[model samples]
Target: MTLNYYPDKPNSESDTAIYLFLRIGKETIKIKTGQYINPKHWNTKPDKNGNHVKRSYTGSPEFNVWLDNYKKDIHQLYNKLTQGNVAISVKELREAINSHLKKKEPTAVIGFFEHFLDYIQITSGERSKSTITKYKVLYKHLETFSRDQPYKLSFEAIDMRFFDLFKNYLMQQLKHTDNTLWKDFSILKTFMGWALDRGLHQNLTYKKFKAPQKDIEIIYLTEKELMAFYHAALPLGSKLDKVRDVFCFGCFTGQRYSDIANLKRNDIKGDRWTLRTVKTDKSYFVPLNRFAQAILNKYKDALRPLPVMSNQKTNDYLKELGKLLGIDEPTSLTKRRGNEKLTNTQPKFEFISTHTARRTFITLSLEKGMRPEVVMRISGHSNYSTFKKYIKISEKVAEVEMNNIWQMAEPKQEENQ
Candidate 1:
């Protein structure tokens, strides 16, 4: 293609020039009579001086209408010059517009994170609702951290360095633990797996960012202490320890929070509470222990409105109540796990989580020399390793029985005094 031009300005000295023109090999077009307009007219604005100074129109609504008309004129001029020959598709127009917009900004990738979020929602149908909520928070943090990067770190596109930095942020900045950091990493890894399956960009730093061994210490109150904790908590009313009750209920019946929270009045029949857990989809026929039933009765009004303790409020409040009961410290409780750090200011119990209830059930039952298989069924553990992990060797139980069999070998009491 070639172009010929007629230079025109209102103050021009030449009147012999026509309009600018273009030509292809055998085809040619000319615009000799059309109006000549300023090139900067597409991107103009008025100055404060109120002068009709040269201006350009931005791609705003007002200017967009004008740009389309101008483009039509150009296309017509070209075809009129080339005899209706240069056919362009819609794709070409889109590309041209995109190129124009991109040039207005730096070469950095824009809205990459936005696109990444859309990709995650579209592809990862396997993610839990809790996970999606967490992803939103993670995405917000990533957006702040990646302000200088070309692309926003995405859920699935994050590298091992991203994980490393994120874990550091959670630990050093947020003061979360190894287990807490692991939860974040696990979600990220799951998202990466989703991304990998969908052929998205893979991270190079996953192995390096991974935390080691991912072990957590599960702890709970002893049966004696649990009773004390509950009796102490009895005065708190609806502000009661539903977690403790639910946990104790879980300890006795082996149901998880997912199943426990969804339990309904209809779930009970002939003193047995039956529920199918949402997480594992396992149905449990728990013969409601008297302690568990007492929890249900105490919280009938509070729990009638909702099934599980959905807020962290009850857990926090229960910790306060536990302190009054002397089961406040981790070491003060017999069935409690040894890995927990005890608080001094007793700023309240922090080590107690929902899992403590499950562990307590397994610990107590195993301490009583209950069969592992029976414990597994009650606790709903599908594996022996998991059941064994919670089967704590009760030092008190061993010490209490230390001289019983040996003393029997020596002799028996001849008379009752």
Candidate 2:
């Protein structure tokens, strides 16, 4: 085997990166060394004038030392590959070289994904807690997928065929809907792209693969249901009562649960809540309606409108509150996976989470003749298309709206006719 070092391409700095070309018989494989210096510094022979030109890297002893150490490491890797007269493919050789160079990095796909999760937390200080949680779930799904593999996966294993197998695994084994599958695959693609950017992996099959997604069926409480929940009797000052008030406040104000959970006394201005939103950084002034204002008045002596709890706990309490209020109307849900159709029916209250409050606000507001633009202001939705999706209109509400429009447009019969 012969190892020749040369530049793969010329960079704008006129300095080119050096790579190792391994020639075994007629087969040659090139591997990047991730080192670069000026062309003048890389010459190993005399000039055309027949005089020896001093190496430029010699001027920097620190750089020279690092270069020497890297070269020695490469030599060791080459020896390791050839030991025991074992035949090594170009892929194995490259993997060995990279594993040696990056001492602590995981060579398997699973290990790299774990490393990536840590990297996201450390590097992405701006990511929200909920956003981080989604990535954590994505990692868990990857662990499940790789649990049955005979050998650990590498970047090389993530090709077009792998995507097919993974999609099947998610459908058959995990029983994931198109939406869930889409989310998982999208996260995987994002991580793979991030890896590519950092030179950790070179697989680009994910680029050709498109994640499956269908329009989500938005479910929200109607005006009657909202009123019923508002009037539901509960012992005064109980935990459920307080949580119900907070949830009702969200339904009226169209604010996110995170924003509502973090609502401070200072964020209130006169009859309006004014501040920059936590996630979007956009300024908003949401005028409080009677229902929302009443909830605030109940906790007037406190520093904030409601006692704080973790989002998960709040959601758990909300589910229990839904059950207590008899909001157990059966809600039918359906989704598609490839050629198969899947369906389920459950109590609507079982699906009541913090997000439902925002949806309720949007849907009920639209049902009560509020303009879409006005509703968007309170909901902090900058995109009209996305704002439209959040409003889940019932067939009754749609019929009522059409009748109202038709009645207004009706022509009066001429009295003289």
Candidate 3:
């Protein structure tokens, strides 16, 4: 790709518009640079370096500098668009150039919130519903912060100062945990990156801004608890009963709630389920276990495979079901806010949600001596970093079991001795 400046009417004596000539392969795009010059000072012939503006003109120095910067901006935009082997059409290139030029003027640039909406609009089709919801939540928090603090939120206003202020706002004002703050920061940075790629703003300070984050405890039912919940009697066709069946299906199959909710009769082939997961869009083959198969047989005549409710409703019902099942062991969660550690303890039943079924499956599968690779395949876990957490939980369970066995055998050995 090449970019050069040319006069609209090179032979005219009066001032004429300077148009940007962008040539990519066989295609050429013309864009008005919004800079004009008299044709008398314009040079139609290109210099050795392909520069067209004559250096002998009165405004030649500044004009040349402007052209150089314009060329640099065009190339930067082209490189950003083509990075990662992305192919760009001539129309896309033109629109990108126009968007970049519009953003160059401070008055023409939209505010941070406006650009964020644009980001959502452009990415909504590619993102999941839950992800889009999270983005909107972040936007709301930022909006609240801007309003309460009476602080202007613009691209130029996002820096270390804003980071510190936002952190304090989330932690102190909103009483949010560090992990929540970290997620908001992460989302903010992602938006900034999207804006940067579009030439919306050149603020790089958000990149250096960091927030504290620590892993939260994973909540899952033990084997005894899972079995108890599965067997707990509710009205046969009640909401809780249906929720239990769906949740237990996930527990038995290690599939995600989204996948379970969307599972159809056609997805079940022979003794295995072959379907693409909702979150990752990856195909998974989950062999039918006795428990999973039984649950499916119970719902075989339903419109869908399982009587799955909305995720929010399912989570609410799960907590209610857990309470009924007496899964109320106290669970403590630790979080950080800068240098301070905050901990909250609640009944384990309160922590149970649709996702808990997935964690329960992974943890129980590992504790039951299922091979890690096999478990990962069934669970559709691609990232080792994420899968390693369940492995650690299983290891702790094994350590306790081994200690108990040693204690019992040591007593016999001592008596024999």
Candidate 4:
């Protein structure tokens, strides 16, 4: 393969430059040292130190297996790149190339993974926090999926059938949501495009991936439902209160579950609270509301410099609590599914979840006529569209609010004793 242009480090602070390279096999073509940008990705809150935090998807033990496979693929790719073991003869580079390298010469199928990892580490840092998280999620699948489908395979071996099945595998077999399916696809498209644009592939690009659908409802809890959730009885104890308080904290602050898991004492202040949002790096502050303050005060004895609840425990307990709340109903039927189904029906829970806290907080605030911009301050959302999406006011609430706009001048008379 030929190096069209030698990519370099972004600035003096870096020693290596990320470059792009390509390899052509007898029947298979390979693209190495490439990276792509995701157009759509959801991110988690940053750690107190302002580092990106990992995210968890909703669902169950089944999803755990999927996530594991995805991570394994990334690790494989990471090791091959950083350690320079992508091909038998591809030794470690003496210097690092911090940018994408353009390929013009016919090269051998080696060092593909190594070159790819260098790209991963470099681009991962520059992308938005959300996009970075997305890369992590999508790459995991790429890693695992590529395990069975090695890089040396012919381009013709991959077709719309494979791409289509992979889409189904992500949504149906892997139990991803409609939104998650598209998100992974979007991320994959960018990465795949990096290879295609650099002349890595003989004949393949991201445009080939098909979308499943686009009609998932923005479901969230109601104000009355939220009140019931907050006031509902749970087994009385400190440990349980910790989870409950954390969930309530999400309701009050609208921070993500991952962000809530990393909360520390110093992040709080007297009479006010502030933090840059996890998903988007936008900063915002709000006068600590009464409910939020009370939860903090109650947890004072057990407070640490980090967030209150462990994500693993909180998520598990949330499922239990959801069932207790009667919001999630039990599903008893099991049907045959291949490696391409979008979701496998699992037992449902009664109440909502930590995510619901965020959606409900924003939705209820909207119902009370809170301005979108002001509500964003508390929720830490950077834009109006995202804030609007989480606001789940039902038709009934809108009708009631609408009725208050007009009325007859005269009122019916009532007798007084």
Q: State each model's C-alpha RMSD to the native.
A: 14.7, 14.4, 15.7, 18.4
Encode model 4's per-residue lDDT on 169-222: one tens digit a residue. Answer: 665557776656766777666666776667767656447676654433444565
Q: Which ten residues in a row have the lowest lDDT in candidate 3?
A: 408-417
- Give per-model TM-scores: 0.55, 0.65, 0.69, 0.55
lDDT of 1 by residue, 1-417 (tens): 544443345344322332434444555444443333333331233245322223332112333443345445555544544465656544453354345435544565434466558756874565545556778776665565554221225443466546556666656665555556666666566656656666665654554566533334456667787677656536453455445565566666656656666778888885688767665666777776777777677666763623466647656755665665666553432221124343334322555656666667767877878788877776667877555556545554566678765766766668877
Per-candidate local distance difference test: 0.56, 0.74, 0.85, 0.55
Number of the top TM-score candidate: 3
Measured on C-alpha atoms, candidate 2 has an lDDT of: 0.74
Off by over 4 Å in 3: 1-107, 411-417
Clashing residue pairs found in predicted model 1:
28-81, 29-81, 42-56, 42-57, 43-56, 43-57, 44-55, 44-56, 44-57, 160-205
Error of 1 at 20 (Å): 27
- State the lDDT of candidate 2 residue by residue for 1-417, as single tens digits: 765566555343455677766677887777676665555555444345322222443233444455556556677778877889888887788788777768834465555656667656864555567766778887776666654421134566677767887888888887888988888888778778878887887788888878778867777887888887788898898878777887888899999888888788888877899857766767789999888888898899986668756778778888898888788999987799877888778998888877888999988888777888899888999987677565545446788878988996668878984
Count of steric clashes across candidates, in order? 10, 0, 0, 38
- Looking at candidate 4, what is the lDDT of residue 133? 68
Model 2: how far residue 188 lies from native, Å = 2.2
lDDT of 3 by residue, 1-417 (tens): 877778898887766899888898999999888777776667777777656667645335556777888888888888999999898899998899889888885565567899899888888887767788889999999999876554557897897878888889998988888888888899899999999998998889999988876766889999899998789878999999999999999999888888888888999987899979777777868999999999999988888888999999999999999988888888987777778877789989999999899999999989999999999989998888778988888889999999988876545345554
Off by over 4 Å in 4: 1-116, 123-137, 143-177, 192-215, 232-237, 305-307, 322-351, 383-385, 391-396, 400-417
After TM-score superposition, what is the CA distance of residue 64 in candidate 2 from its true location, in Å?
36
Better of 1 and 4 by TM-score: 1
